[model samples]
Target: MTKPRGRGRPKGGTDSRSRILAAAIEEFGERGYEGATIRSIAARAGVDSALVHHYFGTKADLFADAADVPLRPDVVVPIILSGPRDEVGERIVRYVLESFERDDVRRRGVMLLRTAVGGKVGSPLIIGFLTRELLPRVARRLDVPDAELRAELVASQIAGMLMIRYVLGVKPIADAPIDELVARVGPTIQRYLFD
Candidate 1:
C-alpha cells in the first residue's frame, strides 16, 4: 500500500518558486491586493507560508514580481524622497522622464499601462501598489494636513500627463521635450505637494 501524504506541502520541489508566483498572480487577480494574504497565497501554491516569505519578503514585493513591475514603489519612493525638499517636484518629474528614455523601460511601461487600461487582471494589483504602497510613503513624507489627499492629487496629475503623452499619444504634450515638460509641470507638482 502507498503511504499517506504528509501534512504540509510536498517538500518544496524545484518548481516551487514558479508555482508560488503563478498562484500569486491568480490570487492577486481574483482578490485584488487588500483581500489577498500570504497564507492564502501559500496555501494556493501548496507551500508553507514561510516558504512564500522566503521567496518574496512582502505582499508588495510579491505583487511586483507577479505583475512584472519594472520598478518597485518602495525603491522609487526613496529616490523621490531624497535630494532637496524644495525641488522634489522637479526631481520626481525628471526621474520618471529619464526612466522612459530607456527603450526597454519605455516598452515595458507602455505594456503595463495598456494592460491597466484594458481592465486586465493585474489592474487592481497596480492600483493597490500605487495607492496603498506608493502614495502612503509620499503622504507620510509630506507630513502635512491632508497629506494623503495631496499625494493623491500629485499622482493624478502625473497619471494624466503620462496617459496623455504616452498612451493617448496626444501631441504637443506628447511631442514636448522632457525638460520642457518638467519645467512646466514641476511647479504644479510642487504647488500640490507644498503650496
Candidate 2:
C-alpha cells in the first residue's frame, strides 16, 4: 500500500507560506520580477507551483508579499501627490527616509536595492515598478512638459541616494539625521521633479 503523505510543505514544515515568501524573495532577487517565475519560486521553496499559487494569487502578488514593506507605491503616490506641488519633493524624501527608520523595512529596502543594482535580473523589475507605479502617477500630477523625463530623473536621484545611504552605508549621507538628510536632499529632488 502507498504511504499517506504529510499535510504541510514537505521541506519547510508547517510554515509553507513563509518558505514560499522567502523563496520568492531569493528568486526575485536573483532573477527579478519578470525572470522569476512561480515555477522557479516553487522549486526553490521545494513545493509545487500550485502551492505558490495557493499562497499567493500571482507573480505580482508574490512580489508584493515578498517585498513586504509599508511604503507601497500605490498608497504613497497619492499621499505625495496630494500635498502642495512645491512641497512634493520634501514629502517624498521624508516619506522614504521615515520608511527606512524601521529595521525590517530597511532590510527589505536593502534587498530591493541590491537586486536592482546588481544588473539584468533585477534592474528591469525595479525600473518597471518605479516607472509603472510611481513615475506615471507623479508625472500625471505634474502635468508639465517632459514629465516622463522629469520623473525618471527623480527616480534616478532616489535610487542613487538609497544606494549611497542604505546599501553602501556611506558616511555623512548614511550617518546624518533623517531630517537633515531630507532637508539637504529634498530640494534637489524638488528641482528634478519641478524644475
Candidate 3:
C-alpha cells in the first residue's frame, strides 16, 4: 500500500526548522521584512514553498519562531500583569538588558533592529513582536497610565542603545563594562520602567 500523504510537517525531518530559521534570518537581514518573501527564504533553504509553509504558517510566524526570545510568556505575562506600575521600570530594564546580553540575543536583536532601521512597515513580525510580545509585558509591569507610550519608549531606548553600543560601536559606550553600562543606564531605564 502507498504511504498516506503526511499532514502538517512531514516526519523524518532533521533540522528543517533550523534551516528555515537561518534562511529566514538571512533573508530578513538582507532584504528587510517587507522585502523578504517566502519564495526567497524557501530558495535559500533549498526547500519547496510548501515545506516552508508547512513548517511555519506565515512570515510573521516564521519570525517569531526564529527570533523566539524564549521569554517565558507564561512567566513574563503574569509578572507584567501582576506587578505594580512603579516597579515596571526596573523590571523592564533588567529584563531587556539580561535578554540582550545573551549570545542568541544579539542574533535576533540585530535582525529586529535592522528591520526597524530599514523601516519594515506593515511587517507584523516586528509589530506583533513589539506589541504582543514586548509591550504588554512591559505595560503590565508598569503602573504608569501611559503604558502604550511607555512600551514604545522602552523600545526606543533599547533601539538607541543597541545602535550605539552594539551596531555602530559608538566611542564611550562601545567598550563600556556591562556593569558600568547597566549602572549608568539602569537608572534611566528604571525611570522609564517606573515612570
Candidate 4:
C-alpha cells in the first residue's frame, strides 16, 4: 500500500518548483503582476496553492524567478536611495554598469529589458512592475512636486542608455569604459533626481 500525501506540496516533488515557475510566467504574462495570484499559478501547475508559497515564499519572489530578472527592486531601490543625495545619480549609473559586468546578469537583464522595450507578451507587466515597484519609493524620497515625473525621466535615461550600450552594442557607449560612462551619465541621473 502507498502512503497518502501531505496537505501541502507533494513529498519528494523535485520538479514541482520548476513547474510552478513555468505556470507563473504564463499566469503573469496573461494576468500581469497585480492580477496574477499564487493560487492561480499553483492551479496552473497542478499543485496546491500552499505549494506555491512553500517553494517561492511570495508572489513577488515567484515573479522575479519566473521573469528571470537578476536584480530585485526591493533590494536595488534601497541601495540606490541610501547614498548621498548629490551622488545618487552616479550611484545609480555605477550600480547598473557594475551589475551588468556579470555575464549571467547581463544576459537576464538584457532579456528583461528587451521584453519590456519591445512590447512583447509580458512587456507591460514587466514595465509596470518595475515602475510601480521603483517609482513610488523614489517619489517618497524626493522633496520635489514632480518627483514621480523626475523618477520616470531618470528611468528613461538609464533604460535608453542600456539599450544603446548593451542591447544594441552601439559604438562609443558600448566601447566606453565604465568609469567614463559613470562620470558622464551620473550628472544627468542626478539632475533628474534633484534638479
Top-TM-score candidate index: 2
Off by over 4 Å in 3: 1-12, 34-69, 77-91
TM-score (C-alpha, index-matched) for candidate 1: 0.64
User: Model 4, range 1-195, lDDT digits (tens) per residue?
Assistant: 986645565553667887787777666655556667898888888888988898898887776677766557777788788878889999999999998888666755665665565545457656677578888888887788899999999989988898888788999999899999999999999998887
Least accurate stretch of 10 residues (summed lDDT) in model 4? Answer: 3-12
After superposition, candidate 2 runs with Cα above 4 Å error: 1-16, 19-71
All candidates: TM-score: 0.64, 0.69, 0.63, 0.66
The lDDT values for all models are 0.78, 0.79, 0.70, 0.78
lDDT by residue (tens digit), candidate 2, 1-195? 986767665754457787788788777655656678999989888799988887789887887677765567777788887888888888888988888887667767776887677755556767788878878887887867999889888888888888899888899898989889788889988898777
Clashing pairs in 4: none
For candidate 2, give the lDDT of residue 170. Answer: 95
Q: Candidate 1's error at 84, in angstroms?
A: 1.5
- lDDT for position 139 in model 2: 83
> Ten consecutive residues with minimal summed lDDT in candidate 3?
3-12
Q: Give the alpha carbon lDDT tens digit for every residue of 153-186 in model 3.
A: 7678867887787666687887776666666665
- TM-score, candidate 3, is 0.63
In model 4, which runs have C-alpha deviations exceeding 4 angstroms? 1-66
**Where does candidate 1 stray beyond 4 Å?**
1-66
